[model samples]
Target: MAWYATGTVAVTNGSNVVTGTGTQFITNIKSGDIFIALDNGLLYEVDQIVSATQLTLKREYAGVTNASAVYEIVPTTSNLKTLAQQVTDLIAIYQEIPQSATDAQDAAAAAQGYRDTAKTYQDNAAASASTASGAATTAQGYRDTAKTYQDNAAASASAAATSKSGADTAKSGADSAKAAADASAALAGNWAAQASGTVDGANYSAKYYAMQAAASAASIALPVPITSGGTGATTAAAARTALGVPAIASSNTFSASQTISYSQPLFSINDTSGTGVAVLQFNSNGSMVWQLQKTSASDLNVRRYVSGAFVDVPLSVSNSTGVATLAQRPMFGTATPWDSANLPSVSGRLLNIQVFTSSGTYTPTAGTTKVIVKSVGGGGAGGSTAATSAGQSAVGAGGSSAGYAEVLLTAGFSGVTVTVGAGGTPGAAGANSGNAGGTTSFGTIISCPGGSGGAGGNPSAAAAVNPSAGVVAPTISSGTIINALAGQPAPNALVLVPGSVAISGYGGSGPLGVGGQGRQTTGAGIVGAGYGVGGAGATTSASGAAQIGGAGRQGVLIVYEFA
Candidate 1:
């Protein structure tokens, strides 16, 4: 009946060793305890059991703490005998050992006791061999487990070293990038001021402020260094240049201005001595040509030139109409129908005459009269007279005065007139008389007069005048009339005067200064009443009617002499 058990199986938490086994196997094996043999002298450490044949064991240790090799054991004679031999040998060695080598002696004795106890418990000498064998097997398992722990620790150490090296490299790269960025920011601040030299100082200061602001705002990273002297360094340089620190005065509006002058030549009237009439005439087959020259205060006047000679036409004033005219004034140089005196200043005239500013020269409108004048008929007297008894003492109603004026085209004229119509007189004390019509005048254009009001009955009053006032001066284009004329009564119809001249004329009024009619052909007039009476004699280009003399109609052109 040989039996064997595992040797020195000690259980432990990873920290402390438990010293009892089989129940107390590794700490002190009983002599007859069953033990199995193995390659190494160390015993096994069995900590937990899973089933009858299974246990958790530690291997690779001196007294059996480590457990990597774990195996199941069955009792048998051959196995028992093998374990017994081990115990016998150990017991002999312990007894023979020196007392000075006490630890060695004790260790050997412990091994022998374990073998004997296992054999005794089974009560078989054969059990001694089996028990010793089991102890040997357990020792080998502990040794294997210890070896595994050592190997794992060595691997972990190696991995840590590798990771540390990688971390060092990454940190170095990050530091380098930060350094580069700092250097770039400093450089940008220095260079920004340099490019602004092209602009003036005041402008440069403004730009400099802007550049400083932009530089202050940015915090770019430095580039990572590469072993190959790599792409990163070049890319970083390009980025630095792109900061585009604007020039101090780059945004200024660049420009300038200049001064100019204009001039014109003045002409003088000149005359020569010698011929007195320094006039020469030529006839090329009935073609008449004349030239005249005269002496004047300023220079020799070349009055008129024809064929090849100069002619003179003396200047004189006429008393009849108070107008100055040459009987047969010969054409001057280049057959100029008009003179510079008649035209406006050269610049103003050119500006007006020419439709376009740059090109397209214009000659004045042909055959168009630049100046015209006209007259309106006088209002009838308020009271009538039996022609025979008419006397200076008789305070007969006062007659209304006639309306007259002239028109002329200055530079700004555009076929428009400034001539305003005249106002007719009101009725007199005891009679009804027709009112005078308003007359028209022209300067740059034609004008129309106002119509007159009708006369009253019984002890009749004069008609109203067409226009109540004198002609107004021409205004700029599109002239505005401050006041308009009142119209005339019926029966004593209005008449309009006509001539080649441009003028506006109003019609004559009825009794007691009735309002006159308006006419674009001549002028417009109004009539008067009550104390306002029209004068006696009235005449128009078209007609003359009524028992007593009606107010005169307006004329196309009324020429008057001023005293």
Candidate 2:
């Protein structure tokens, strides 16, 4: 019945209810179940089983606020383990038998010794009888021979007397030996009987105690089934098997938990042999891979599988748990362009000014040589839309840039002029190309022509005026040349163009809408293109008044010196 569940925390910060989204993990939980927050390692007991999705906690549910984190459900007490524990205790406490049976064995051994001693005595008695018989025969021979001597002399009579005395002595010794042998045989028989009676009908007292113990051991009933728990006899038998030197059985364990280990790998060569061998490998999940093997008598190589290969892991006092873990982030590679231009090989001073005016002085620091000048003519103003017609909007051309120029000086030049360019002005009602822009100069060192003005917009199918071209770019000494940005084509009235500027530095194109009568004064405006930039063009259908076009913007001159 002992079990555990894994679930995620679904809600937090509630004092009474702890909710979980996991179906199985939260469904079976009852009152008194324990709840744990994995992140903060907080433990709480369930006070009430509120519902399948919720539980009443002993206290406020507080810990990891993240509902997605995990918690473990462990049973406090259950029947599955009880039978095993009870059986184990029985095996330990009542495993021995009584020792009084050893006394019977000692008595039997004593009787055997007595029987052997009696056999020796009987052999001695038989030898004594044979000696007596021989002596009697010798006496008879002496008497017969003496009768023949009596006829010859008195010496025969004396020999017969000596022989008679010897015969009497031999008979007395034979009788004594026979008596001693009989007594020894009788004593041997008594000892043999005593040895045979040592157990005396096999004492039933031991059997009684043994039967009682067996019944007690067998009567146990477990609330749940277990491989190691059953009807008493089966359970006891299983428990007894634990006494054996268990066969290890692959990874099966005998005790509650055991520390497992292996000899560190011996370095003969690279070993790729998998588990049980001292080599690293990836598991089915590509995780939990490591090994320790002996190298020398004392050296161990700890290794792990990494990136589809095996590599050594660091081993020291810290490796007591026999685990080596690794963590890392993803990786990448890249490349960039390489050049000397824009690459700062040497340091220099370059001053920049971009304003709405024209013609300014440029003073280079003492060692100035080459000067790169970039110029942009002002933008032209937009053309104004018609009044009392459709609501029309017009766009203007952006200012043109003279592009760039790198001028080489005759060395140690004192200074040159500086110029800032202007942007185009906005157009108003009734105006077309507002005004022409002023030209800009860099004090003879360089000069920029002004941008052209835009023409007025007309609903009468007339083409709007195009902006004028900027100055022909200044010529430079060497290495770098001058180029001008392109100009925009003239815009027709009622047009649409998004971001119609730049790649050529042109301004936005006009939107397609017109205005009412001139007196109404609400028409779309066009921009002009000069040094202060061209003014914007304007349009109005006012009575008897003509709408004006935008003015062009002013030009600019820029100077740069490098050391």
Q: List TM-scores for all candidates, in order.
A: 0.18, 0.27
lDDT of 1 by residue, 448-509 (tens): 34333333222112222222222222222223333222222233222121222111122223
For residue 352, model 1's alpha carbon misses the true position, in angstroms, by: 20
| Residue ranges of candidate 2 with Cα displaced over 4 Å | 1-358, 389-413, 419-432, 459-479, 486-490, 494-556
Q: Which candidate has the highest lDDT of all?
A: 2
Best model per TM-score? 2
Clashes of each: 160, 78
Model 2 scores a C-alpha lDDT of 0.40
Candidate 1 C-alpha error for residue 101, in Å: 99
lDDT of candidate model 1 versus the reference: 0.31
